[model samples]
Target chain A: MDSRKKEGQMKTNDILEKKSTRRSFMKKLSIAAAAGSAGLVTGGCVGGSGSTEEMGLKWEEYFKKNYRMMTDKEKDETVARLEKLAKLQDDANIQMSNQEPREKVLFGYAFNISRCKGYMDCVEACVQENNLDRNSKTQYIRIFEMDSGQQDPTSGDGKYHHEVPVENKYYMGIQCFHCENAPCIKACPTKATWREPDGIVVVDYDWCIGCRYCMAACPFWGRRFNWGEPEVPKEELNPKQHYLGNRKRMKGVMEKCTFCVQRTRQGKLPACAEACPTGSRVFGNLLDPDSEIRYVLKHKKVFRFKEELGTDPKFWYFMD
Target chain B: MKKIFLRSGLFCLCFVPGAVFLAGLPAMASGGGVMERIHHAEEPYDSMAIETAYQQPVKTVRAKESWQGGTFRVLTRKDSITRFRCSVCHTDKKVLVKDGALFTHDDIVMNHGKGENGLVCIQCHDEDNRDFLSDSSGKKIDFDHSYQLCGQCHFRQKRDWLGGAHGKRDAYWAGERVVRNCTSCHSPHSPAFKTKMPETYSLPLDQ
Candidate 1:
């Protein structure tokens, strides 16, 4: 019995020694994992590989920097920093042009709602034409189809798709109704969003301090604020960049439809107007009386959007 | 052994019904039913020969009218024949024959070639031309439908309607929608463009 007790004690001692060794090994492994994570965070290789300058900025500071206020040298450095930050966020080398001047042009659009077939082709085309971050919830056109007998024009919603030629439905396409007396322009203290000579409303992306006052001031709900940096694949990116439209925008900035000004200023129609299968949308100089739009106004009964607000929007609607 | 024999007997019982079902398949495939007989009976009209025979003498017509001093006059007949015309497809039950002789002469002179096979209205419009009867709602059954009546000669336009390329609907406002019929935009006899003025025509408020 004494020998058996000694043997049991020896076995106990051996088991305790083995357990202590395992515990020490586990402690060392945990310390190494923690140190490695700290290194990754400090080296700017975590979540996104954004530059130290961009990474250190607070969300508020990111919103407040006005691109226009910076000198040429400052702008160049800032653009380079932003490009590096974008690469880190995407984990892919992205080519970003901070030197490209914003191309501003006068542009307008008119929708004859009576002719729209609610095909959603314009909505799809806009998504393709502009390399919108698929995950970043940005949309340029919102089509609304209200019940046929709804007096309120706002009742029409465009977010729909089904069979070809839907019956008993009227389609109303809504985009940034660039107002002549834009309240968004008034709200922007930095003058980031402003009206142009050709009646187009433009945004100076760099100058915008991301004060969402412009978004609140827009009466038509036309503006969209980017919550995160836009993520577009390299292949899908619209390489032919424009200042007023189709330029990739960063996070925390306000964007609205530019009426495809990048395409229109080059003597081409807007993407939405071109994609319409039925000639429901007529686009031309409101100044030219001989234009099809003029003919429609002269012969057919026509009305502008929200005329009572006195914003003097360029968009118009008419019946066949 | 007894249980195995009983299970086999039960299998045969199920197989007999299934075999009977299979045996009936040939009869079903032969289509020995009333629907098949009726379909087979409709063979003659399905023949190309009969279709050509019916089409050969039918007249083709095109007519236009011009308005002058609140009155309209027939311009000219593009083609002229005196038999089996538009009246072959359309019956003249509700004839607007006020002065029968003058009407027939003017119609024949103006729309003689306007029918299917260059036949005049009088050729089929007469009492004996009774084969092309239409299922109409009215007492005398003049034409099948307003569009069908027009379709007898305007075949292409009729095909377009079936293909959903052409039709008329009411003007839709923000809340209220209304559809206007074909006759609202066209005149049967004159075939002239009509200027559409609203029911309560008012000058623009700005004007």
Candidate 2:
């Protein structure tokens, strides 16, 4: 009821925002006209009828409220819009959802450095499972092959092109740590990035501006800026998507791993964890005492990559 | 008006089921002769062995299933164990395989553990039981129950497995916990993992 009242007030504010959005919309339309697409608007003739390309980029797209503060109705509208946009652009039937996290389940992940063979299967699994931007090769997972007796992960080469499980050396993978005290959340000016109840930090993609503040703030180089419209082959596209997670990302937005929110929320393992052939990646609910992640933290000598920064990363690393 | 419709629908629905139930009430209360016969056939035997509920492995992937492609899978112990049953060759006098008995497996190179020289096939595979494996305690365990035999030696790994630290748990995380046996990854004959290129998606250029 409170949100509905707030939304009503926002609807009044939307008219104020629309006047400004109209100026930008005019500029974009003029640019479209110069590019020989003048027929799109002029041919419509009638009001709000059959304005092909112009109708898709209406004033509502610009005036939509920030996701976190939006009402449930607004969220549903946003999800529907995103699904329609995906179908129009990619010809892919994507399910963009606003799925809530499982109750009492705070996710934690741990990987054994010793066990990782630099197989990079996790990276592949993450790409396919998440439906990440293929054209930009935007991989959220990066496995670092650290030299033997070297503790520094930054020095480790992620670009190594050799047969792995190198003798005397070990491999360590890094992704969005989903920190409890996340810096990316602080850097997102629009309140687009926020940690879910399950400790998986997610981005409201529609709300995010082109500003790369979150990418700049992230210590582990976790975030990826989409340079152009992310190109995923229609055949290879993963239909299962979450609006705040792995839905088809638009251009000029910063994206990172959400620990496979669509899968994890439904009592399934993260793609990377499921694909680890070495049994190195362990994932479970941190709130559940009997969970594997808790066992790893309690029993194993686990440490986060950037422990000094005090990000309090939910993800951990250990050597067995 | 809504209440009237709901009430009429409920009344109709209740009568439909109630009428059918009333018609069958006498027959059900009297009981079927077939059920009585089935109850009588269920004999109680105090001397009968109390067999445990069989734990069927519902997982698709197993240790043996992921082993090899064409010839290697056929030649592996999983197939040979069933084909050339140990009891077929090893009778009254024979305890283990002699020279030519294992000559078919000339390509076999045992390099699993450091104590491979002292180890014989019968130590892990039960000499008496043809179909089952045995732990150090001489417990007759089914082939599916390889974890019991494996847990005897690799206690730390076993502990981790039980704690959900080591080994792969299949499909989903929340439901029934179904994990892989030791053989799902490690080869019984030669346990070392072969080094190779990663899957195509994670190549340097792709990154």
DockQ values for all predictions? 0.01, 0.13
Q: What share of the true interface contacts does each candidate keep?
A: 0.00, 0.35
CAPRI grade of model 2: incorrect
Show the colliding residue pairs in model 2: B63-B184
Per-residue lDDT over A15-95 for candidate 1, one digit per residue giving the tens place of the 0 to 100 score? 355566556875896688577656755667555655565555422234333443456676565555555555565444544
> For residues A291-312, could you state the per-residue lDDT of candidate 2 as single tens digits?
5676687678888877777566
TM-score (C-alpha) between model 2 and the true structure: 0.72
**Model 2 bad stretches (over 4 Å):** A1-62, B1-109, B115-118, B200-207
**lDDT value for candidate 1?**
0.51
Each model's lDDT comes to: 0.51, 0.69
Candidate 2: deviation at residue A148, Å? 2.3
lDDT of 2 at A269: 76
- How big is the positional error of residue B112 in model 2, measured in Å on the Cα after superposition? 1.0
